[model samples]
Target chain A: MKKLINDKERFLSDMLDGLKQRDPHIEIIEDTVVVRKEKKSSGVALVSGGGSGHEPAHAGYVSQGMLDGAVCGEVFTSPTPDKVLAAIKAVDNGDGVLLIIKNYSGDVMNFEMAQEMAEAEGHHVASVVVRDDVAIDNEEQRRGVAGTVVVHKYAGYLAEQGASLDDIVKKVKEMMSTLYSIGMAIHPCLVPTTGEYGFDLAEDEMEIGIGIHGEKGISREKSASVDKIVNRLLDELFKHTDSSRLIVMVNGMGATPESELSIVTKYVMEALDDRGITVSKLLVGDYMTALDMQGFSLTILDEDDEVLEALDADTGSKYFK
Target chain B: MKKLINDKERFLSDMLDGLKQRDPHIEIIEDTVVVRKEKKSSGVALVSGGGSGHEPAHAGYVSQGMLDGAVCGEVFTSPTPDKVLAAIKAVDNGDGVLLIIKNYSGDVMNFEMAQEMAEAEGHHVASVVVRDDVAIDNEEQRRGVAGTVVVHKYAGYLAEQGASLDDIVKKVKEMMSTLYSIGMAIHPCLVPTTGEYGFDLAEDEMEIGIGIHGEKGISREKSASVDKIVNRLLDELFKHTDSSRLIVMVNGMGATPESELSIVTKYVMEALDDRGITVSKLLVGDYMTALDMQGFSLTILDEDDEVLEALDADTGSKYFK
Candidate 1:
């Protein structure tokens, strides 16, 4: 595989080393967990994490006004329960901790197990699962994708405001109900460890409703124009929410150029405008990604005063801006 | 090529449409120039631009403390002199304007023409050309790459501080002397308009010192590990600057994954540490891109007290952080 890496075994550790070095405010612990250098003395701590490839998601969100810690796993793999527990313990300062778990089977299981272990140690911990990906017909089977970044931002904002763990969990869960995301990929990414493409695609084909881990999407069809592809994705999302105003995120699935994302953004905004919907906030760039997949995802969240306030609030996150 | 675009002819306009939609603070004028919605009233205005594919370079840097305006050209083509003059007229206040031009034959010529036109129109204009790319042996012919962003940030900071146009030009010219940059590409990028790859590269080969416009580099060799590639690039940069402390920017060439960039970052920091050099600032991610090219560039600038203060200054820029 043509990737800028050394031994596959060292990918996670080496990436974390670079993260810590770039931001002095970020501290690495247990070789897999990243937390704030200065712990908040009070307030419910926010912690989130998953596989390593969807960078700037969990780790890049770590800061005072965002996530307090992130538990990282190997590329496209779930972190161990011990690592998650370490992040919870490292950030919790008595007000309790909130774990933001993306709705993937492995991630949900591991994060839940860590929550149990933390509670067994007498720390109050609450968890919220983000199943915002609308690709799957069955809601429970949906895979959380770029919408998870919005979860971190909103929940982290609540935590920074000194909200109780239970309140933060309740609000985040409420917000997830209004969040929906779907992605399409023209090229599949190679799994660094396996040294193989996640899936094969003919030159003229594209995958719709693809997952962030490079999983096969709901369907494969002939490539189409940006407007057609965006209309299809938004058609799926429109079925889930009828909100007149929304907060939109045009996220790139690694390797997609920012120029393309901006082009995608234009179509998305035009599509929404035609439907007489207003976009309250728009974020266009890569937030979550599949190693080197080339595609884009569109996420829409129902606009609310609290949601807008949280997203607009100041944050120390180096990536969110 | 599998790209998310509607019409090749509408590439520049569509991208700018999305940019304006996302940030209401930005205004699109003359069909090609991007200026701040609220222009500065007194301080010298900073205006820069070139080709359209380098997202967030000239346009994304437009804000209160970064750039006052950006004149966008067609994909991989320099902006017309009329567009450059339009940008100058749009952002120029009574304090005059400063143009940051990257050292490309077409760009320098067009921006110089625009400068003369603006001067004849009675607007005081100053221009600085950045020749920071160390890929070419001759300093005069070096192409400005990602290091142009540093020039934007540093000079923008000075402009925001109310520095005189002449002083800003003088300081920026001095700063350019100590800046160095180099890039390498593994896979060639397909220029949308041309419908062809910029250069040819085998699966096992890579190009060193590749230009942002997809121009061929100085050498081609078998792809190596991330550490080795970074060392080779740094070896060239080390010959130019002997500064003990430096500000480093690890820029992805459009399609490189952030995980890979972080891994590259790890090796860069480690190499500098082993060499007894200290990194005072670190900026990573896709700051300057080459339209989905698979590679990255390293930019290093000498660290000075004034440079640090400018780099650390706050800005309304959405991408610089």
Candidate 2:
């Protein structure tokens, strides 16, 4: 696969070790759980995690104003319930713990199992599944993509503010409902274990509405121009939500250059301007990635004043800031 | 080339427009200059620039605690002396201005010309050329690479500290001497104008000691394991200089995934550990990049107390913080 890893099975561990070396504010718990070094005495601890291929997503979010802990699993695989429970136990201050689960079957199941296990031990635990992908017709099947980062920011802000678990979960659920995302993948990513791409497409073709895990996209089409691609993604996103003031994120699906992300963001901004939408806050970077997938995703959040304040809150998470 | 650019000719401008849209603290001047919105009232204005393709290096560093302004030219081409002069005029408050030029023939000549012009226009100006590339045997031919960011951080901190132009330039020159960098490119990047890869390498080949502008490296070798490649690079870097305390950066060359960077960094840390070199501060990510080049560069600075303090200083530059 021409990957820069020592061993395919040890890729996630090596990555986490590297991250811990760079960021002193975080430490590893039970080998798979990454948590803040200075735990809060009492507050709703925010925890989010999934597969490990998404750089700076779940682990990078483990900081002061963002996630308290992130339980990392194998690449494109969910962490076991024991690992998630360990993360919850490590970061739960005294109030409670909230797990921000992305709407993937394995992730939802494992996180829910962990939540139940934690609750059985007399600890307050709540879960919110983020399903912001707009391409899927059925809400139950909609996959959470890069838009989950928005939920993390808002919910983490509330947790840092000493909000109750119920309050943070309720707010995050509302934010998830308002958020919408869809992506186009120019190329599929390689899986380290198999040393093969998850899928393949013709050079002139792209997978529209692709999930972050290299899952089957909604459709395959001839790769169009950047503007046309942006228009298509935005058309679907705008159909799901509309607002004069909004918060937006142009997320990379890994391997995409920052310059290209900026280009995509430029057209997305132009598209929003055409609709007379005022972008209150915008984030342009790889908050969530898909393991070297060459494409970008557009995320729009219909945020209120409180949500905006939370999004702007101070977070030690370098990815968020 | 699968670049997300609108017009090949307008790529740089479009990228700048995208940057301005995301960062409200930065504004463009004279169409080719990016300056901080609020200029330093009376301090040494730090100016640095090269080609346009290095995203976030010269421009993204223009913040309160970083460069006062960045002069941008065409892709992989140096800016005209007039553009550099305009940036100097725009940001020079009352104290003076200092130019941080990477040791490229075009950049050195153009920035020197601009310095002379600015001097003639009654502005105190000085320049320092950073030639930290260690792969080249001849000192005159050594090209500046990712280590220049270390110079920016130190010089920008000094500028923000209200140090005089002479003082900032002196300290930066000393820093430049202690820095050394080496890089490897697995794949060549496409130039926007030509729409062709700058250089070609076989599927099993890699170019070692490559410059940021896709210049020829010291040698081509069979693409070996990541550990073997990192060892070779580190062997050269360590041969140039060794110290008990150092600051290191593992910079991605645009198209390399963040996970791979982390993987590279993992081995880097282990290599340092084996050598018993303690890294005081570590910076990892795409600080300076060639246009979508799939590789990475390692920069090691034998940093003393002052340089370490400056590296840790607060800067409005998002890439740094």
Candidate 3:
């Protein structure tokens, strides 16, 4: 539990400073508290941001092929509306801006408030609230999890190509229609300050549909067979899906091994094949992580070839392909 | 424990197969079973490889800015010399080749024997064997760990620019003299087969100088404060380093968290700063991870701005920059 931070309070600032040093193309605005890099097209800009624990997500994706700006909140917490609005405005070209947000209540509300404020400032803006987690039962209220990655990809891809606000919103709506994700945890990850676990599970057990913030999953069980566990997840998820072509992901929760993830991927691929779903693209590694939680998530998105090609595009991060 | 692999034996092959699918640039030779990209570099082929568990060490570095060829082996086992030599010959461009190696006994013997074989075959090949583990002893016989990253950067930078074998060797000698690394583990990692742990340690205790292959380390003690652990590791590592101007790394052993790694990084920066070292650069995350192992390591390289600039360069893998 010993850590190497200078101070728990300053860790965010110091880390951001270090990140800025490595990529001078990024502009860290203290006034707005947003991270921005120049974009080539003067079009509708895409803004995506949330907690800081998920490295290479909002920030790492802020490159030429992805988001124009990313706003990072304290770990697991949503960025304030002020920061979100600032990021939206910073990257907003005359065309408009699109906010891709997770479906968490706080995150959705904050991004919505930012959208309202941006509209007040005469900026054309729309939002795509991503609720991709398939682990929960009440479809109307299921929590968002790793499926946010799809939003980062589609939203950013659309915005980078000068898609209009309406076009971007339509694209994100299409994306959300096809995306589904479910995750399990073997252990609770700690917030840096508390060093207290965010959640708990027995050493031999796992909880499905666990929230990244360590929210209790819908169900718990002694860790079952890989095929059984993957099937259990697929049973809940695939029954609701409407398509057969998919982009499958077996993501690590920060602490699982890549080798182990590939192992999980084997079962996932087999399960998808058994169900007659054609996996057009695949990613089996830590794309979105939950601090130090020891487990992995299965994200399945039934998408067309365009989305699959975008997902398969070259990336710049340690975990992503 | 519930991995989805077909069989533990074919796990590595499956992973490589997936990697090949995603990266059409890399080619696997059936004749010698060597994996490499078809980047037609007429310069000497820069080849490096080791066990499979320590992902990305050799393969991930095979993009345009990095290595030319990489040979893969089973988990925690060195690739045969024939495979290594085959990779060398396949990529050899008459200018001679540079084999960058970690200091594991298996890796050293295999690569050394390959070097002799390559030289005997009229290839002007030289090598830079890296032994940067500061955990145990900074002697000739000590093992190597995360400092292989440093070697990867310099060796790849030189090799990419078509540096001759002699030039790359001389450069690595100068660079090797200035880098050192030390690591500690909280729990032993589970190997695929037999599900056996690398070593045994009490839950409340930790082992310092942990080898990536789970070799015995230097110190075993009750977990201490992050600052204390950093100081202890620094006392041993800086004993033979000029880390006054350093590229500091706080790397996780697979299962450690960025939350935990950042904590360790704070202590690392403090310990080095207290000793009057000017922090030239910092990389905090999982670079070289032991498969599903719980622990962290600290690597310091006395680097100039040139080295930092090169390190900042992009690689095709997930986690650089």
Candidate number with greatest DockQ: 1
lDDT of 3 by residue, B86-111 (tens): 88888786877788888788888999
Q: Per-residue lDDT for A98-128 in model 2, tens only?
A: 9999998999999999999999998899998
Candidate 2, residue A30: Cα displacement in angstroms equals 1.9
Candidate order by decreasing DockQ: 1, 2, 3
Interface RMSD, all models, one decimal each?
A: 1.0, 1.5, 4.0
Candidate 1 chain A: 10-residue stretch with minimal lDDT? A15-24
DockQ of 1: 0.78
lDDT of 2 by residue, B1-321 (tens): 566777888888888888888889999989979998987788889899989777768788888778888999988999999999999999999799889899898999999999999999999999988888898878877888888888888988888777888888788878877799999988777787788887999977899998888777889998876788889999999888868788998998887887788888888989888889898889998888888788889999886888988888998888885
* Proportion of true contacts reproduced by candidate 1: 0.71
lDDT score for residue B60 of model 3: 59
The lDDT values for all models are 0.90, 0.86, 0.73
Worst 10 residues of 3 chain A by lDDT: A312-321
- Candidate 3 scores a chain A TM-score of 0.92
